[model samples]
Target: MRTARRWRHYLKPLVFALCLAPALWLAAGVRWPAWVDLGANPVEKIQHTLGLWALRLLLATLAITPLRQLTGQVEWLAYRRMLGLFAFFHVAAHLLFYVVVDQQFAWPILLEDVAERPFITVGFAAFLLLLPLAATSTAAAQRRLGRRWLALHRLIYPAALLGCVHFWWQVKADIREPAAYAAVAAILLGWRLYRRRPRPAVTGAAPTPARGSSRD
Candidate 1:
């Protein structure tokens, strides 16, 4: 445990860099279009990439628990918060890019998209749900919220489901990618439900009366 704890000090930085790399790469593509091609439709490419990473990281965050249980390495939990926050980070960037770049901050059109477009509606809902989770992810917040914290965090399950639906709806066809994500999410969430299922109470049988003893 000591070694794992010590190694985490180094590992966290590496993990953080890995999580940030996609965003950096996207930024570099924008900065050096000559070197890094963002395809013919750069705006769409960037937005999709950011949203993809959000979904990937969200699923990864959910995987940590099953991974820990399967591998018996409790240390896997150390990275959950980081991964979840990065998921929120990417999703927020995804929304910002769509609003600022795609819509040019046109409130009427953006609101219309949210209201009329099913994919956008779910995606926006997912982001709204994630907002509180990210805001309350701090240790201090967890301490302050106590048991309520766990209940609040449960929102991730629905957020993830909505994210998957958003992705599936956004894609014109070829749902294999979103299907895979949904499958993994199902397994992870199903495992959690299985674990939390109420077990039959272990009732002890009443002791037999002493042989030949009085009924008093």
Candidate 2:
């Protein structure tokens, strides 16, 4: 277990860097657009990339519990909170980029988009769901909230679902990518439901048939 603990220490930082890599790459592309081709439409590319990473990381965060259960390794949980927070970070960045750059801080236009666009509506709702999860992610908040924390965190299910819908609805065509993400989200959620299903009680081997007293 010394080895396990040591690996945990090293793994967190490595995973943190890996989580940050996409954002860093996007930042570099923004900084040096001439060197890095963000396609003809850099802003759109960056926005899509950020939103994509947000969904990916959110799914990854949800996978932690199932992964731990399947593998029986508690270590997989070590990164769950970090992964969740990064998911929120990317999502928040995605929204901010849209509001600041894409929409130029135009609240009227932003509200119009959210009001008129189904994709934007769902994406904004997903962001709102994630907001509280990110806010109360700390150990202190977890302890203070107790069971309510678990209940509140359950919002992630809908958030992830909404995010997938947002992606699918936004896509003009070629829905393969969004479909893949939706499939993964569905599997993860299905596994959670399967795991949580009530099991049949053993009843101590049927009480040895009670010496054949009227019933088998």
Candidate 3:
């Protein structure tokens, strides 16, 4: 209906802004360096915030199909692309912040971190997997790749899994947050797999022998 379409149009921008809010908030920290002790370690704070949002948005992107199926509203698909793109943006930001600010683009140090730190390796791998997914997100690539697009997009599961592991492994003390994220990812992926499973074949019970008809 017209109302539904109007709401959808309105929601796109609203959701976009909502998604960007965390990044914008983090950026504001630069203006007020002493705001809540962020000045002391702004890089680490921004890095962690961006990384968390990236995982959250990736999980949001993965929820689309299940949401559509559950609600029977195909319109939800319209937002999935933007949501996924924002996820990639957050992830790219997270990684770039680490490489540029934290590591100062020092290749030797960066390579050492990737090689020696298990959590960093996992996070880097997750970022790498998201790269192709982001690149092929356009209509041109989708059409050109055809079935291959779906197959490539399936990489999201592994990427999300790696992200969860990376978060869990990186935590110095508590892991409840990462565990919660992992649970959410597992549930979402499980739902997707459940939806994809083939249904059992239905069969009649020998046709009931025609209920004692003429062929007695």
TM-score of each: 0.90, 0.92, 0.89
Clashing pairs in 1: none
RMSD of 2: 8.4
Tens digits of per-residue lDDT for model 2, 21-68: 999998989899888778989899999999999999999999988876
Q: Give stretches of model 3 more than 4 Å off.
A: 34-39, 203-216
Model 2: lowest-lDDT 10 consecutive positions:
207-216
The per-model lDDT (C-alpha) reads 0.88, 0.88, 0.85
Please report how far candidate 2 places residue 159 from its true position, in Å: 0.3
Per-residue lDDT tens digits for candidate 1, residues 4-96, read: 879998999999999999999999999999998999999999999999999999999999877777766677788999999999999999999
- State the local distance difference test value for candidate 3: 0.85
- In model 2, what lDDT does residue 182 have? 100
CA displacement after TM-score superposition, residue 184 of candidate 2 (Å): 0.1
